[model samples]
Target: MTAGFFEAPRAAEFALRNVRVPATLAPGAVAPATQDGHLDVDIAIASGRIADIVPAGTIDVARGPDLRRSVVWPTFADVHTHLDKGHIWPRAANPDGTFFGALTTVMADRQANWNAADIEARFDFALRCAYAHGVSAVRTHLDSFSPQAEISWPVFAKLRDRWEGRIALQASSILAMDPFATGEGDRLADLVARHGGQLGCVTRLAGEDHVGVPANFDDYMTRVFELAEARGLDLDLHVDESGDPEARTMIRIARMAAKRKFKGAILMGHCCSLAVQPDEAIEATLAACAEARIDVVSLPMCNMYLQGREGGRTPRWRGVTLLHEMKARGMRVAVAGDNVRDPFYAYGDHDMLETFVQAVRILQLDHPMGDWPQAATTTPADIMKLPATGRIARGNPADLIVMRARSHSELLSRRQSDRVVLRDGMAIDTTLPDYRELDAIVGMK
Candidate 1:
């Protein structure tokens, strides 16, 4: 298959024959008009951006034949993921399916095994999976607690370079409180600057009894904020990941960002405790988050699997943060694959399509006729600050995915398809084989 041009070619005209464009750009928002469902359109790529999209019949091309049955949508922009952790450890069956058990296993693995080579191998695998799945852009969290920035940072830097053409990689340094206290935090910030990585923080770190290190939480967060400002870097925190009712770290962080006018650079991932909070409190906290311009990310697969309670009890599940509510409040919200084949989450196969499916069920998003799958996929792109992606429009990058299915519901319900993927206007699989055969090759079946 021909890969997309890394550097924009000098070509004046390019044509995509018989491709169906999604009905709208940013479907829910007020944007330029675009025909929905199936259509035959000619996508002209000039200087790496789509120059114009004309009706398919407008183009008179001789080199290629008709591709009338294909549908094309924007390539996915994955807002949140943990490339470092996603590749660590094997997936072991957790009998209890509790968050604490998963945490314990991760800690044990860190102590027992896991080195640079292992981490690099896993990271490479995850990136390959993402590209094959049509994720053109991703924000990945890399653990920064280690003093060996000489080691960890380089791996990520190399990975970033390796996938430079196919994907946009944003590296975030995942700093814990204790490590920052020991001077690793400042060092991490420096490394982030040197390597162009983003700043990340874990407001609470695991203690001996599986409790949070309370004494250092506030002080560490202060340093994190300061460092982010000093480095002019984006701040993303894994705040309030615990199912514990008392975990109010995210609320405090939101208040701090607001007081300091940090703008919209802050992102809070897996604020799972919000689901268990009182309605009034959740609303108030969400208001503060909106004011702070903080983005929120919900990891349905990991949070749902790790936090839910046992038995058919009254309070059965400790659901993820209220995603739909946050979006309604005008706060940015994104869904992420927090872990894949890692100790924390054994289920993810590096497919955001699967992630979206789980998110729809967890968020209970319902339309009058039915749930809107295209909207679900598009919303997260906006949240992640990925402007070029998530929509099909003239002058936009021609990165798109063509699913075998006919409609959004069919795509979601079936959850597996042989997609004819494209990047930078180049067909990922030029063979254009049957969807069923392609599905088997990708192990989607």
Candidate 2:
């Protein structure tokens, strides 16, 4: 009916009447049962928690805005992202839009300008975008190489405190595996533990391109596992992001996880090569992942941008992991917005709704639609270990995204840019930060 269809009342208790929510996201009983995988209910909010749910028209509509069967979703959780490297595209544009270009350009950019202040400014900006778009939790990978680790982790900790209630933040240290083989790995792991962060590294050695898995892959992976085990830290890694079929470290990491019985959780991002591997190989890897209890977050946006690019040829094959197969095997698979406005992705506003819409198209996550939306919401939240987030169940916080779209068709066909983001039963200001705000820092002049 309007640009922003729903507005919560100023009163503490209110009702959202005639709203439709995915049945999977809405837990507990209601007067009217779910139909076609969705539930049409009136949700009651008391003191910022979901108080009750009943069939639409069963509740008085005067308490709050009548949503007219609009689709409601819980606030999102982005489990894989690069906040420390976000919004640096102006000064550090990828030279050729290749993986190599992104890697080298970001390296130079980090070296030249990644002081605490610079990182804090950009990191806070990204968080603001995410919060406004209804993301309640995020796990960002910080570029943690030597001095950068010393610098970025502190900024992340500070931001974690600053954005506490509005947006839950988690950080992971990311660099090449070579550092993990040396003493520097121990130091970084210690820093991560100090900041309550995850220990992470790319599954490749230093100076190695995205070809085959590095020859020392096992040795370095062993070192990384040992470091995490010693510190009692979880692992979040950038694994096999390359389209090169030879870049098959994801399976190895999974196998190693099963062999070592690493105590903490493991979340591996971007396993792009798995899509290109033979079906048997793909199944085997996924089996290993399931056996190891490894959680996978596919960065579809960034993978599509970087995976199959060449200078003067039409690229083929979407660079995404075998999500359908993995899901069939009962593995926890999530889709996330990774590297927003950075060299690896080039574009994104830290918006999870957009990420889900694009993922639906990029990975063909539709046809049946089913519970696939969970990949961007409940599933990622589960992976991030934030159980309280990403679902609209009774007794949970009334953190929700109320959109004009009532069905999956309308939800996917158009971008819900004007969706209302409610945090604790109050609508937050969804205004995105202006890019000009970083003109000076990013050298946009």
Candidate 3:
């Protein structure tokens, strides 16, 4: 447990007066202002709404002096994370440092070291780090295979109530697709429906894994889709997350969604296999996903850690999906720091900026500050379809992040971590638990 970017944040002044931001330019914008149509806009937000947004030095009446240099933008959305299994490296260490190791260790730890309070403490701390880092929403995948959902759902309910206007927390079930074919599906669906959660399963379309993937394969997804249709819930699947070239579960899922005309949103994360697939296969899947209106989340952190480790030769792949290609096909793709300080990923603090930074490097988005904002900030939030959390506009809620960097380039180059996160137009304190103390809990000695 190391305190880096994930530590809790101190309080900030409650109000931002006349902070300057780019009117036309924004992070993750499809393109910069056409014909240099840029405006240095001074915005004032209050009561959870943009009170005013006028060109800088153009207010009709006398305004207060502008002093702070910052860029105002939407707070981020970590679309994919493992809250139930996060911050448990000390309690359970993965000696193999592989995907299988992560799966087995997480399963064992959930049975042994995990309970209500311990899970709540770790998950709450992760949320604090995200909030302080200017994240307004996070969608975490809970370990729903066991009865832990009974414990986890209630804990999240309490935390959601506590963090209510400041942060929007979304939950998804993480289990194999088969069990959903039986009574477990019905019970989980009831909990999910009651709590407004999604129906999720880890699907590995082609082959099988003893852990972390579905052995029932594409057939079981029928029950999953039927259950989602029955309950009016969205589907979130960990699809094609392996290094195997033939693991094309995502394509199958997309095709099925189209075949059945699945009602709710379909979000597929990981998709590591797509990168290594044949061009024909890639194109076919992309077309299907685009036609199906599916959203894809690229998890760079854990994939980088767990993929391509079994080879005797140098690791040729980066353990991520095709970002540029997906965008080319008009797929709604995003990036998230998946598992932090868990067996899946040894490092990460749930900081969206950190994830965005790594995404910039991995996806080669440094040029023109490519659509990084759209993917990291707005895309996932819109997927949740929540209010006051999607876009930055006059009528939208004042859920935004004002960064220390003065411009987009400077923001990326300097990475000024100092930020003021406003939830419904007011100040709030941040969260980060001490990793060293956690080591003692996990028996560091």
Using TM-score as the measure, which candidate wins?
2
TM-score, candidate 2, is 0.97
Model 1 misplacement above 4 A: 1-19, 24-49, 55-70, 87-96, 208-216, 309-315, 368-385, 429-445
Better of 1 and 3 by TM-score: 3
What alpha-carbon RMSD in Å does predicted model 3 have with respect to the real structure? 4.4
TM-score against native, each model? 0.82, 0.97, 0.88
Kindly list the per-residue Cα lDDT of model 3 for residues 1-445, writing each as its tens digit.
2222222122221234345454432322222232222235555555567665655544432333353445677777888998777788877888788888887888888888778888877888788778777788888888786587888888878888888766788888888666676798899988988888888988842224523335556668888888899989998888877788878778778888999998899998898988888899899989999999999999887888788877455667888899888888887888988999889998899888888878877777655655556778778877878644656666677676766666666667765555656676654454345666465446566
State the number of backbone clashes in model 2.
Answer: 0
CA shift of 219, model 3, Å: 1.7
Residue pairs with clashing backbones, model 2? none
TM-score-better candidate, 2 vs 3: 2
Model 3 lDDT at residue 175:
83
lDDT score at residue 308, model 1, on the 0-100 scale: 62
Overall lDDT per candidate, in order of appearance: 0.67, 0.88, 0.73
lDDT of 1 by residue, 98-212 (tens): 5666667766665544467756766777777887777777888776656445667888888889989887888777655677665677778888889887788776664432233
Per-candidate Cα RMSD to the true structure, in Å, reads: 5.9, 1.6, 4.4
Stretches of candidate 2 above 4 Å error? 1-3, 29-36
Best by lDDT: 2
